[model samples]
Target chain A: MNPQFIMDGLVAGAMIGLGAIGVTLTYSILRFANFAHGEFLSWGAYLALAVSGALGFLATGLTRPIAPFSFGWSLPLALVIAIFLTGLLALVLDAVLFARLRSRGSAVIILVMASFGASLALRSLLEFLFTSKPAYYTKALQIAVRLGGGLRATPDQLLSLGVTVVVVVVIHLLLTRTEIGRSMRAVSENPALAGIAGIDVRRVIRFVWFIGAGLACIAGTMTGLLVQIRPYLGHDLLLPLFSAAILGGIGSVPGAMIAGLIVGLSEAGAVQLVGAEWRSAVSFVILVLVLLLRPRGLFGRPA
Target chain B: MTGASPIPAAGAPALETRGLVAGYEPDLPIVRGVDLSVASGELLVLLGPNGAGKSTLVKAIAGVVPIHAGTVSIGGRDITALPAHRKIGAGLAFVPQTENIFATLSIQENLQIAAAVLPKARRAERIAAMYAQFPDLAVKPARLAGSLSGGQRQMLAIARALMVDPPVLILDEPSAGLSPKIVADVFSMLTEINRAGVTVVLVEQNVKAALAIASRAIILVEGRIGHEGAAQDLLDDPILARLYLGTGQAMEARRP
Candidate 1:
């Protein structure tokens, strides 16, 4: 009967939804579930933190709060740099790891296993760089704003939801309207055919890595802002990310977003009802049930 | 080429390859040392037994397969070093044997991706041209290509290839899985395309249907051209039997 669960669910859902877009896209185009995708979130969050810390030191005025928002101009600027750096990281990872494997005609299983290795390497590197200590974007406190029906959310939380909507809508339009986005879909559909049709397969791959990791960066920044950042932050959410991606269907952007919310709600509801220990089980249960009943998922054919 | 008329390079073969050897791996050359020339505005059908490199030869020419050694030219343009994506701009278009269309995409999306290589102003006009040619697709541009009938899928694939109005269009096994009536429709469509001055190189298993519309035919055996002549000259029993059964030369070479 508590409305607190709704707020918790939505905030987590937005983060998971954004993260799941990267997972689904890598899986669809690259033909592998990139376990390293989760590490991008950790790297992104830490990168933004490092940049914000430096920027705040350079120009103390940047740290001033942007109205009701907890963080200010520094954080936004840091997010931009973090997105670019994260995107570059994704591309380098693919070039050094995945692209080499593809050239050698590696099997999907090998690619998946290689991604597991990448995930470990990335996470270990992140831990060594930033340590395992929990970090936050801001220490400023926020009071919850009230809405109708006993609902309440912080300005940051509302921003997260609004941003997710904008990201999803923009991505949808890109896929449908833009030449590059349509080429991405074309490559995902039939890579060889896309190449023969005059689509630069490598360029599409680069774009995917950039876009996928950029989205991951946004999700990571939001997570750091909302909760506390830890080395295992993305690791902890891996299951929910995969669940949201698969439950929404493999390649559908809107599906992943909606599915993220569903997974978030389920986990939140489960934590409230059966204690937090059962929260992880919620996503797994939903994944199993969906695969059992609707194998293609809500939007499996892709957008 | 999409907005303006297609003009084949005068006095140049539509597509040409010399000393071509290609396959998935560098050491295993499925298409070995093929010297081929297709004249402008010709419908040349490639016929061969299984593993004779019929598909591999076309794929190598298209830059889809890894070439161990080769030179491929389109309308006198040297495109041997070009990547597969750039070949379309060089006046050569290739439609793969399978997975030819973007199955998850709508008919319009598939055409749009094909036309993406065209100029912005010419893209819509090219797509409209495709729709005009293939009425089956025009009726439902928004429909998913995967759900289309086998015949319709082939039409869409051909249409996608024609979107750029390439001087040379190479198709690998365009008649592999289609029904007889559908095969006729596809062959007739190719004939129409060839008549419009597009050079077509089709690899086909349906010998009778393919030769019906083709002007010339080449039979490949063990990665080498074993026979070449007028299309009508190939319909005889000896050639058709040679198509299904390999030349005894390979067996003789294998004997200790």
Candidate 2:
């Protein structure tokens, strides 16, 4: 296979790794797969697009793409805004919908169904607001930088990789070094005991929603930056992200990241070895193989 | 076994159940019109055979199970409407028979979480006090609660409950399945805790051990109080002992 293909695989893998981490964390902590997570990516992208467009209208000179990375200032500002907004949206969603259901002692399957409804509502809302037309943050494509072994990558790709690393590290520290993090882990392990221990299980659930949705926002924005921005951007990536989370073990953060990268690279490699048409099938194949052989995924502890 | 000294009239009972009728389901009341009180610094043990509703009574007081009728008041405030957390805040602590600790958390973390309502500045001091009281816990505070032996886990559970400094601590069969040695150690710990002015209510299958430490004792048969009196009185009464203690066979064998 071509080295360009390998580099392409790594770039794509990084995004998958980031998105999968969010999926895995949410699953482990919340005990359910959040189907609406994909909408967060679209929300983030639209936020950046809207902000950048407003900035461009304010200053004609700002129409030019930023140096090093070809996106506009509006994109970065929008990403920050999008992360907070999306995170808040997730909190509200939990409070208004999931929290009530959870309080009623709703079953996991019912919660999963609720998430599905949330996904549909969010997807349609994005479509109604943004239209179906594909948009871009920046028209200017950066000059590809050649590394070694005939591999070349755009500056945006490298920036996305750096962002992924930073976010993962920060999250790792938050999970391991902080008091709230310990409480979160405790709640995840046994909510009743945690409650009796005075850990405030509700507060932990709120925090999980914020972090998971915020990470989903970042993942959505990064993916948008690397490719085209569309309302269904997150939806398209959902399968691979879920696959990565499952493969990495549902609650293991590092496992999700590693699994994501693996999925990304595998898809890229599959495209290279077979054809682009087979790329979408890669995650499914891995899912089936892992489910059959390991059943618990790579990091899943035995039940 | 009839006349155990009633709670002194000066201060409030550590725990009081006023006509408590409780159960897991609404249609069935497992504890029917049970009224009891444990005074400050008392080790009151509830002894009964299986299906005697001992667990249900304790759970109702702890706000774990619903009380169909009656009130559970801690100190002076009525806590029948309060949730479990509020009940804990009101100075009541509960140690369940099983899965009482956050298994994945370290022993220190478990205790820290239990002290979550305390001020941040006082947490370290409170933890130190607990560790001093339970020195065996101090040795492996960093170990996961799940990895600890059964005896150590029970100690951690009790320690976790004590972190809130509750005046009344309830344990559901603290020695249900432990060996004789561990059971003795647990009973000794209960006595020490009671001696330190923490009111303790224990539910136990080991009739003799429970009676040995208890200041007051109550025996429940099919959810109603069958026998109530002093611990020593229950121990000495042959008919009461035979009926409730399952020592009928041994009592007959030793007949003069």
Candidate 3:
């Protein structure tokens, strides 16, 4: 086995894992697979692109890389802005569309369909604004340091993975050590009961969108840092993100993270063994196999 | 029974709902034109046959079901427009019949979520108090609520409702599907809890067991209140059961 594929998969998986966390959360709390979640990633990338460009005029030093990493100071600043903006966008969309439909007791199918429509509208808007061309943050390349066993990774990749770990740890603490997280879990388990218990269902929903979208924003920014940014950046990762989320268990956060790495490695392995063309198909195959075998996924409670 | 009620001599009713008309959808009111008042520190048992709108009535009072018409007051404070979640902060807690506890959350977390609105310093004391009240829950605080037995779940549900230390608690059929022994245990627990100064309004089908502890009882026949007042009074009058079960008009007409 070529160790390089494993290295590539680890980096790619870290990004997907971050994305899948949001997907799993929305599925768990909102009880629907939000097709428009991918667009939040798209929004994150584009918003960063725009912000980084504007900040270039404000501080010339911010545009420069912070040594050993591909990302510039402006990019980090851009990420913070992007996270809030994307989270706000998610809230606005929910307020305008999903929340009202939910209050009226719309079925899951209706919400899913509305999400599909939301995805199209969002994707089209991104395309209309950014055009079909690809964009970049720094256009500078970093030197890859050799780890061992003939494998090497750039500092950017390593940083992305480090950030992923920190984000995951923060989320774990939030869910386990805090009241809001406990309330979120309660709402996910049983909304009616949670409501009667005095957990504000609407507030929980709002917080979920904020956390989920904020995480996706970081993931998208990392992806843009690793590769080139495009309007379809999030569109390309949607299938694999869902695959990881489902394979991990619909509502389990840690399950989604581990599943993401597995999916990413599998896709990378497919690219090496079968062909790059077969890479995307690997996730769908895993999704089908999981559904056929362990339909509840690894960590999901049996429904 | 139809007019505005006189103010009770002892302070105010813990819970009062007047002309409450609500249901799941428009043009289909399950609980129509109902009035109820439970005095402070009283255990009011709401009895009726299945589909007599007993659960619907409690749900409307709890703010789970939207009231199409009428007012609901907790401790003389109008809370008809408050949503279900806000009711707890307003000194009202509701324990739903099914899915009353957070099934996926651990027993400890279920209590934590219930007391989320409390000050941080008081949360641990509140949880410890719940465990002390229900010794069964204390042993398995880490266990998922879904894994608990039917009787344990009911206890956990009641414990979760009590987490807020609410003055008024509304339970919708807490003992719906349990063994006779478990039913007796649950009713005894309710009696003890009510004694602890939490006014309770319980909707029950177990008439004999419910009346054993209830200070007052309201029997609903269809969407209307067919009988109300002292629990023993309703229990002693055999015609009340006939009226409640809607067995025959002859038994209802014979009521003195």
Candidate 4:
């Protein structure tokens, strides 16, 4: 097994892990699998692409890659724009579709179907606007920095890994240390009791959408930085993301992150063993094996 | 305990339902033309057979079930049209018979969620007050509500309700499925709470125990009030007890 191949797997695994956290959070809190979550990733990436393109048009001189870790107009600025835009898009989607359905007492399965419809609409919208062409943010890809043991990683991959860690940590703190987070847990456990307890269930639900969608956006944009951006980028990653969430246990954030890493590394290793053709099948295999054996996944609490 | 001075009528009733009619399905009222009240600082136990709409009546009052007819007022304010949260905001607390606690949350967190309607600055103090009231809860404040025994969970449920400091607390069979000792402890707590001037409306199948703590009692047959009077009067009267409280055969005989 080449160490470089392992590094490749780890980098990819990190991105999947980040995406999986959002899926798991939404699933646990909303009690539904949001099929449209994938669109947020695509949306986030496109948001970054659009912003970067607009800035580029303003002044070709401004289009120069910023110093330190460059992708033109500073990575931080680009990420902030991407996250905000993606978060806003998620909120709008909820307001327009999911929220109304929820009020009408729509079943969970109906909500799931609505998410599918939403995904199709968002995906098509992206395709119509951006075309099917693959795009990149930076003209110059950063040189790979080699670590010992035949492993090499680019600065973007390193930055993504760092970002994933920060996001996961912040989420962990939010869930454990904050009032809204506690309310979220309460609502997830028993919504009626939470309502009687005076928790604004609707507000907590909105927050869940924002956080889940926002994370998906970050994951989507990061993946774009690592690879090429396309409208189907998130769709392609959806199965793997879902697998990560299920593997971690539906509502467990830490479980989702760990499961995501497992899926990432496993897919990476599968490619090494069976070639790239088998890469897509890895998540399915893990999902099936877990469902057959554990059913609860690695960290899922018994229902 | 009949005619035990009435305690000078202690302000208006905490909850009053006049000709209330409610049910899950439209055109089939589970609670039919029921009129009842629980005076402030009083404990009123509502007893009935399994399908007699005891739970439905309270649910309607709490705004959990839609009232098809009549009015529900809390402290002289008409709240028949209020939603569940608004009803809670109006100082009405309901502890359901089952799934009453947020199982995954800690005892402290459960109380915190209950105090969510209160301003942030006051929640901590309210929680502290609850812990003080139930010092047993203080020892395991960090324990998950799910991990507690059935009795402890009931206590936590009651404690969560008290977090809002509601003037009226409604308990739907707080003693259900608990050991006799636990039931005794719960009744004692109810008495203590009543002494502290919180109005209590209790729905119980434990006729003897419920009557012992209740200042007033109502017996329901089908959806209508079969009997309403002093707790001790119903407890002592053989004909009334055998009719409405015992076997429920007499109560069923009078159903039509």
Best by TM-score: 3
DockQ, per-model, please? 0.82, 0.51, 0.79, 0.60
Q: Which pairs clash in model 2?
A: none
Model 4, span A137-243: residue lDDT tens: 88785888888889888877887888889989999889987889998888788777677666777888889888987898888888888898999999999999999
lDDT of 3 by residue, A1-303 (tens): 688999899999999999999999988999998999988888899898899989987988898888988767999998999999999999999999999999899999999999999999999999999997988899788899999997899999999999999999999789888888898888888888778888899999999999999988998989988988888889889999999999999878899899999999999999999999999899999999999999899998898
Q: Which residue ranges in model 3 land beyond 4 Å of their true spot?
A: B1-10, B245-256
Alpha carbon deviation, residue A173, candidate 4 (Å): 0.7
Stretch of 10 with least lDDT, candidate 2 chain A: A191-200
User: For model 2, what is the error of residue A92's alpha carbon versus the real structure, in angstroms, after optimal superposition?
Assistant: 1.9
Docking class of 3: medium
- On the 0 to 100 scale, the lDDT of residue A12 in model 4 is 83
Q: Which pairs of residues clash in candidate 4, taking residues 3 or more apart in a chain or in different chains? A: none
Please state what fraction of the native interface contacts candidate 3 reproduces.
0.98
Q: Rank order by DockQ, top first?
A: 1, 3, 4, 2
lDDT of 1 by residue, B137-169 (tens): 999899999999989999999999899888888
Kindly report the docking quality category of candidate 1. high
lDDT of 1 at B239: 44
